[model samples]
Every structure is written in structure tokens, then in C-alpha cells.
Target: MNGVRGLLGVAVCTGLAGCAAETGYADLEAYLDAARTQATVQLEPAPTLRPVPTLSYGASALRSPFQLPVGASVADRQGAAVPGMNDPARVREPLEGFDIEQLQMVGTLSGTAGSFVLLRGGGVVYRLRIGDYLGRDQGRIVAIGDSRVDVVEVVPDGAGAWLERSRTLALKTHS
Candidate 1:
């Protein structure tokens, strides 16, 4: 074991001595310095950004797309009254404040007077009957069927006349 140890030590010392010898590349360093000095780095110029054109909206006279058209309602009022049309002087109902689209017919109720349409809106349920107003436009409840309620809304025709438009709200069943 002593002899083997001595041989291993000698082999390690020889390996280390070989590594200690200088491996010269003095010409490579001089060449790299010369090349670096001679080389010129050219960068591309930054691209010019064009100014964005300002847009002017000229649709003050036009009706907004987000809102329902008021022309039909105006024309309806301006035009002559049609038979079975609602009276504008009648007292408005609780559900009349909300838009008809926002109101949902959830169910129906029958009473001695007549059948009533149950409308749900703004987290509250309201019972509406015939002649009850329920839309942004003076939409009066004309008829109440088993699963639908018909409302007649007065709208303006483009030709300066009022017209009656029928709108229905179907019953919504929840599972």
C-alpha cells in the first residue's frame, strides 16, 4: 500500500507540473487589439414616428347608437290619435319608469277586474294590467295573454307622423 501511494503522488506531481508550464498566445492578444481598433461599429438611425391625425366627431345632430331612438315616440305624439290608443293624461304605473326591455314578464295573475301581467324589474316584481304604462315611450299594456303581454308604443314616423308600434314581453320561467 505504501508503494502504491508513492506512485500515485508522483503521477499527481507530474500532472500538476505540466499544467504550470506557460501556454503562450501573445500574438493573439495583439491581433485582437489591432482588429478592435480598426473595426468601426455603425448603428442604424432611429425611425421617425408619424404624428397621429386627430379625429373630429361631427355626429351631434345624429342620435346616439347606445340610446333607443326617440323619433318614433315624438312622431306618434305629433300625429293624430288612433282608436284604442292610450290616453296620455292617465296616471303612470310603477313599472312605467323602467324601459320595457328591462322589464320581464315572469307570470300572470287573474282577478275579478281582469288578468294582470307580473313584471320583474330592478329587483322588484310589479303587477301590470291593461291600460298600464310601462316603457320609456308611453307604452300602454294593450293585452295580456297566458305567456305574453302586448304593449302599444306611440312612435314618430320619419315623415313627421305618429305611429303605434306593438311590443310584447314573453314570460320568463326559472328552473
Candidate 2:
């Protein structure tokens, strides 16, 4: 009876050990399967964030109809050098300088000379000659297209007094 009881005790202990081992094996298999599935989850690069498409209040406004405000402060985004950095007060000379302050065309230098005469402030101030040295474009009396203009040139016919004369200075435009 002692031998049988000892054998039964040993058998019971062995069965419990087997059961625990089986359970441990099953837990390990489950853990391995979970790890493999996670490894094969197919990870890809993250998508980039894009700007949203938006509309303005006046979507049809292609260009500004008004001119930009003068002396307005503006930030230069592009790294371009400022133009005309040499001269700040440089300005191109005008063609003719004559004030209409009670000014009248007296006469040019020569009678057939293509010059302009301007009487300003009750005096003959400028007798703009055709080939008078000036700035860029040479000042010349030419018929602009087909416009009829009346100009006057002074004729010094060996006379002491320069007689006030009239000549046509026309500047016509093509239609």
C-alpha cells in the first residue's frame, strides 16, 4: 500500500508539471505570432502636409486697377540688388522749358529756322533754336504726323528792329 501511494503522489506531481509546461508553451507561441504580425504590418513613409486651396474675396481681381501708393514701405522678398544706386536725384532733362505765364510765341531765331519762340512774363525769354544743344533728344521743329500748328521764327533781315512773325508748327497724329 505504501508503494502504491508513493507512485500515485509522483504521478500527480508529474501531471501538474506537464500541464504547466504545456500552458507556458502555448503562451510563448501566441507571443511569437503577435510579434510576427506586428513586424509584417507594412509600415510606409508618412504623407506630407499640403497647403489648403483657398479663394479670395474678389477672385476675379487679376491686377490692381489703381497705382501703388508712392513712398510706401515694401519688403523685398527676392535677393536682388537695388537699381540706380549711383544717383538718387538724377532726372532726364525735358525737351523744352517754357512757362505759359502770360507767355506768347514771338518768333524763332531765323525766319526759315525750325526754332520755337516763347515770350514769358511780358518778355521774349526763350528763342529755342532747332539745333540748340540740349539733353538727350535734339530739339527740332518737325511736323508731328499731320497736325497743323502755328509757330513763329525771327527774321533778322539786316533790320534794327526784329519784326514779330508767324510760322505754322504743326504736330499731327495718325488715326
Candidate 3:
């Protein structure tokens, strides 16, 4: 019965395959159907990414990991807001009239917003990360370690600069 069913499936698929033209004409037809003026595909402009807001580290933000709300402190925590996220004192006034361009990204790490790789413009280059660096010389990262990163790449987090800075992690584990 299984052999007969398999043969039947193949016969049906072969009939269907022969019934339709294999050529891809849909895209060309859609292109031709549009008014000639607008039909020309203008490359969608690369989105203007709001420059990553500048960050600073200093004595005012001195909280230890043990003292933090989640037991992990701001130190070495990347993307940290200095005083607070929505403090009125930080900005002179609410920013309005500027459009926020939401970027479509090919995500690297699988999670919430914590650690994700961003592909800005379409077909743009990707900087390699941890798993990408295994057994390759181009993967040589100068600072930080696997345990130190929320994701693979090392970021300049200035909690204890020496702790995460200037340190090197070799690709191979030394015996």
C-alpha cells in the first residue's frame, strides 16, 4: 500500500509539473504593467540610522553588581542610560518632528532586544563574531571573553575599563 501511494504521489506531481509553464514571468509582467515613469526601480534609499546616542561613564553612575535592582549593575552593562532613560534633565526638551526610521535587521543572536546584529542597508557587509571566528585568523578579537559578553563581539563598556579593555582572548584554549 505504501509503495502504491508513493507511486501515485509521483504520478500526480509529474502531471502537475507538466501542466504549468516553468518560466518566472510574474516579476517581469508586474514591472511592465506599471507606468513607465514609475516602473524604473529606484533603489530604496539607505535608511538614515539615528546615530547611536553618545555615552559616558563616571563617578555619578557608581553602583556595584550586588547593589543593583536585578543583582547585575550598570558597570559592564552595555547600552546603559547614565542617570535614567527618560529623565527630563538629560534632554532640554522632547524631540519631535523627526521621523524614526525602523530598520529591518537580519538578527544574529536569538533573543529579545539584548544582543542582535543589525544589517543596515540591504546587501551590506557583516562584521564577523564569536562562532564566525572559530579557527580563523580574521576572528582575532583583542579584548573581553565569552563569559564577559551578552553576545559574541566585544564592546567598549567603561565600568572597569581595564577589566574589559586591552585584554585578549585567543581562539584556541591553551593546554
**Best-matching candidate per TM-score:** 1
lDDT of 2 by residue, 1-175 (tens): 9999999999999999987774547788989898887856668989998999997787465545443335532232123332322235744223334322233334334345443543223343444443332212212332211233243333332322233244453332231
Q: Candidates' TM-scores?
A: 0.50, 0.21, 0.17
Structure candidate 1, residue pairs in collision: 72-155, 72-156, 73-155, 73-156, 75-156, 75-162, 76-162
- Give the clash count for model 1: 7
Candidate with better TM-score, 2 vs 3: 2
Spell out the clash pairs found in candidate 3: none
lDDT of 3 by residue, 54-121 (tens): 88766667756445456555654544432222335633211111111211223334445334233222
lDDT of each: 0.82, 0.42, 0.38
Candidate 1 per-residue lDDT, tens place, 29-129, comes to: 89999998895988999999999999988998898775547745644546567653466666767776888889999999997978998899898998878
CA displacement after TM-score superposition, residue 77 of candidate 2 (Å): 18
lDDT of 3 at 38: 79
* Highest lDDT scorer: 1
- Superior candidate under lDDT, 1 versus 2: 1
| TM-score for candidate 2 | 0.21
Candidate number that wins on lDDT, 2 or 3: 2
